[model samples]
Target: MELRQLYYFVKVAKKEHVTQAAEELHVAQSAVSRQIHQLEEELGVKLFVQKGRNLQLTPVGQLFLKRAEAILADLERAVIEIQEFMDPEKGEVRLGFPHSLGISLIPQVVASFRKQHPNVKFRFKQGMFPSLIRDLVKGEIDLAFISPFPREHEQVCGEVLLTEELYAILPPGHELSNRHSIELIELKDETFVLFSEGYSLRPIVYEACQEAGFEPKIGFEGEETDTIRGLVAAGMGVSLLPEMALFYSGTLQPVKVRISAPSVTRTIGLIHRKNEKLPLVAKVFHSFLLRYFLDYNAKREQ
Candidate 1:
């Protein structure tokens, strides 16, 4: 019932070792055990059972753990909200981005945003599409940059910044590498280097190839854009990558040809929790990013 008891229970549940949890909490081992026991006594339920040297959560413990974690997270967010509300311009924004955007897009936006709001702080998390979404929904991150923008999620809302083309990246000595633009079908017979199954880009590329009347033969699969580009540059296979990943790609330069026929593209956007208020600092960042990309895309069109 007490905050400290819930905190202790959650930590012990996660680490599953009272001694280790106490070590991390910077508290005495006996104190941690006493608090956990008090918590169980108050609830009249055994939260954990000993298994070998570790503790395993019982079914009730598992359910209580979720609620305890959520309560802690809500309290943390409330504290941040109050702090940010005091001075929105000087508050912190927790932003999440995918690996694909880390090299160029994110850095560019963050650098420019900092120039305008120098005192504003940033906490960043770089992850894949699913992880980013998970963090956003869980309130772990205030806002996130997502691609192939999610259609409709019950717990999320998003706005597309702009759509960017996906290029066919060929190894240096490939036969059609000289062409400025080529059809997706042109690489049908060539082995393809692609993102692994769970990545957002994988499905987009697959559907593009299928639309072009050939199932791509994936010769190599990778989760990182740099890895995929390296594979292509090393003559492992060709790949379709977003425009941003190809910029300033040191030494390992894959030949980036335009995907003319299918014109593969994906939407890049910002997503946040649905029906929830973003912290003041996050709201400022969210607005700034929308305007920034809007102007960016407008200039590109002009």
Candidate 2:
């Protein structure tokens, strides 16, 4: 039976009067009676019996009424949940970021956004750049903060949020620690502690060194930046890391020297599925980040 028929039957069963049920439903009594008769015919069971001047529910009617009430209630709740999902101020946004950014940038941005949109919630996933992009493409995340801005793709798009220079991390007493800046070529002969495969930093640094006419002699590889930084601090090897990562590194921080003579830098950006329409909450947060980074860059320039 149709939902409308079930609706009419339930109302008539509750009121125990076809005429009164019709009045409450804003329908003619004959129309309500016809729908109820149609419902009974579809179910192959009589739902009501004549009881002088009023209607009485049959045993089958009582059972069906409970089920119909629950179905209608569930449908109403589903509508409300869908509406909340479309509400910019009250929904959730799934955000992704690389471990490097998660250490500082993502936390700071999310905290500031929460202050302005208190009712909006967030789910965060942390991974390397490649993993983050995979999640973005698979719809596991609404937006991601990734480095190098990813290559052009038909289903993915992004806008660079900020560009940060890369610095060389060295032991406290290393000879180059005294220099204002060092060239990538100078590090060619030195042992390097590089990011493990799949990190965007690895390729950027590798290509930069290659462009400088040498392949870095790799001493060790680590997935986390902090681990690589610690290795540098212990004089294990040298590494190129972003400025933001250096800023947040605490007491274990190694000496960071600027890279010069064809300096290396990387771009961080917000990426998402190109054709997917973001939920209202995610769309607003995306715009908020664009503004946040613009203001951040303006301040850095000052």
Candidate 3:
């Protein structure tokens, strides 16, 4: 039976008067009667009987009325929830980023965004560049913040958010600590502590070292920036890291110096699947991040 017929049947069952049910439903009395009659015919059961001036429900009518009410209520709730999900002010956004950006930059942006759009919830996943890209491609994450900007792909689109110069983190008492800036070549003989192979920063460091006329001698491989910083502090080796990485190194802060000659930097970008529609919440967040970075870059320039 049609949903409209079920609705008419329920209204008639509730009021127990066809005339009043038709008036409440804003339909003609005959139309309501015909729909209810159709419902009874479709179900092969009589739902009501007229006795004197009042209508009484049959035993089957009682059972059907309960189920009909529940179905209508569930449909109403489903409509409301769908509307809220499509509303830009509500729903959840899944975001991905590397460990370094997750430390502060992402948290700060999310906090600020929540102040205005409090109903927009967030789910975050932290991974290296390769993992982030893999998740994005598989639809496990809606958006990602990737470093050095990802290469152009037919299935992916990216916009550069900001660029930060890479710094060399040395042990506190190292001789180079006294210099205002150091070149990558100067550290040619020193061992390096770097993120594992899949991390974006690892390749950036290796390429920069090669550009400076020597291949880096990797002494230790680490998964987290904190661990890498600790290794540097323990004099295991020096490392090249972005500004945010150094900021969150906490108590294990090593000596951070700018790379002077053949300066190296990494670009952070917002990336998502190309031509694929994002959920309303994710789209709102994507717009907010674009504006957030624009304002952030302006302030940094000042």
Best by lDDT: 1
What TM-score does model 2 achieve against the real structure?
Answer: 0.76
Write model 1 residue lDDT over 2-21, tens digit each, in one string: 99999999999999999999
Ranking by lDDT: 1, 3, 2
Residue 295 miss distance in model 2 (angstroms): 1.0
List residue ranges in candidate 3 displaced over 4 A.
1-81
Model 2 lDDT-worst window of ten: 245-254
- The TM-score leader among the candidates is 2
Write the candidate numbers in order of decreasing TM-score: 2, 3, 1
lDDT score, candidate 1: 0.91
- Candidate 2 has an lDDT of 0.89
Candidate 3 residue lDDT tens string, 44-141: 99999997766789999999999999999999989976776699787778899998897789889999999999988788999887788889989999
In model 2, which residue pairs have backbone atoms overlapping below 3 Å?
Answer: none
Against the true structure, what is each candidate's TM-score? 0.73, 0.76, 0.75
Question: Model 2 residue 278 lDDT?
Answer: 90
Q: Give the TM-score comparing model 1 with the true structure, all chains together.
A: 0.73
Question: Candidate 1 clashing pairs?
Answer: none
lDDT of each: 0.91, 0.89, 0.90
